[model samples]
Target: MVVDIFIPCFIDQFYPETGFSMVKVLEKAGVTVRYNKNQTCCGQIAFNSGFWDHAKAMGEKFIRDFKDCSHVVAPSASCVGMVRNYYDEMFYNSALHNEYRTLKKNIYEITDFLVNILNVKDTGATFNHVVTWHSSCASLREYGLKDEPGILLRHVRGLKLVEMEDKETCCGFGGMFSVKNEPVSTAMAAHKVEMALKTGAEYIVSTDSSCLMHMQGYISKHNIPLKTIHIVDILASGWEL
Candidate 1:
């Protein structure tokens, strides 16, 4: 199937490799993926921070960018959740509401699209190391993406998926929450890192890069050996022992 890839701001600027890997995975799976250079922010930051007007404008731009595509997929669940669940509210009474609705239905998180639409579990990846999965709040509770990732991860040739304590707990990177409540955000991230380290996981994998970025900051500050990875990277690296 043909799909439009939505690379969030952070992923585009800081984690371009993940976007590249996502494209590789999709191409390998026999899907035609297109990247729209005009694509910009999903207006999630502003929307969540209570700036509906700014968010509406941003959402309008997003709709304009991908309105013609059959499906729009994002590497970050947080962004997917934003577009899928919040765009309508952000543009409810605006002229763009109809376009917003169309964009919302076509958007999908990478994992959700892979498992649900692609119908393929194993990406044929092989990373011979102990790893644990972190369920970001958006991907887990908001999008109800409980099994798609697991179904895919389990099939990696030599990867061992371990369960950590409080697997469903937020990594404490609630967008603006991290900036507004640094102390609380850091504390929760530290706790989440502690649990992942306790499992002796060589890597902490998740669907959201925001969580990984937050955890990585703490992991680096504290000199923790644990590594953070996006699910797309892992899937793309499939069975490469």
Candidate 2:
């Protein structure tokens, strides 16, 4: 059960703990994890910004980096989604088309890999706080992840998993969208934070760190008591923060 861990650029830069926490959860479940330090971004941001030439080069490098791994797991749904769903198209008509397509079959977002591939429902996690799960737009629509997080959360000892309204709504962290439309992004994130606050949950959890980052921005600015947590952080809490 050796797995290759793909740390997205954002996670590598801002939330490295979540990546390590994911590895802890996997190892706790009796899985061996390997990280390729040479790995870099999945080129999702460049692709989304319509820089196909640059993104293709980045994607090619990404394929070369993880093409040999038996299984590729990433905590960021957006990066995993880009690699799994979009890379094929990017590689179409290119020499690396088959290589990229083959890699897609092995790439899995953390939750999807845990629930679907590993058949792991829980990581023996325990937390006393009440938490709400945020279904990031990419996780919900792109990855089609609906119940995986819920299944894992339910098994945590002494943790209450509450559902917030409009869980499917985006947290306004569509990568460049947040930067291009700051006001709208802030407004959407504010609404999302408000919903989490109404639940009286101490933490709002999501698989996507970008969404949490956006929502946390608003939460921090308004001095909200809520804390944004990645799902892996919650699951790996059984070991230690």
Most TM-score-accurate candidate: 2
C-alpha lDDT (0 to 100) for residue 182 of candidate 1: 97
The weakest ten consecutive residues by lDDT in model 2 span 232-241
Every model's Cα RMSD, please? 1.2, 1.2
Listed in order, each prediction's TM-score against the native is 0.96, 0.97
Off by over 4 Å in 2: none
Candidate 1 lDDT over residue span 1-241, tens digit each: 8989999988998999999999998888899989888889989999989998898888888889998988888998888888878876767877877877887888899988988888878777777778999999999877779789999889887789999999999889999999999999999999999999999999999999889999999999999999999989989884344
Report the lDDT tens digits of candidate 2 across residue range 143-223.
Answer: 778789999999998899888997788888899999999999999998898888889899999999999999988888889
Each prediction's total of clashing residue pairs, residues at least 3 apart in sequence or on different chains, is 6, 0
lDDT of 1 at 184: 97
**Sequence-dependent TM-score of model 1:** 0.96
Candidate 1: the clashing residue pairs are 124-238, 124-239, 125-238, 125-239, 126-238, 126-239
* Candidate 1: segments with Cα more than 4 A from true spot: 238-241
Candidate 2: residue 53 Cα off by (Å): 0.9
RMSD of 2: 1.2
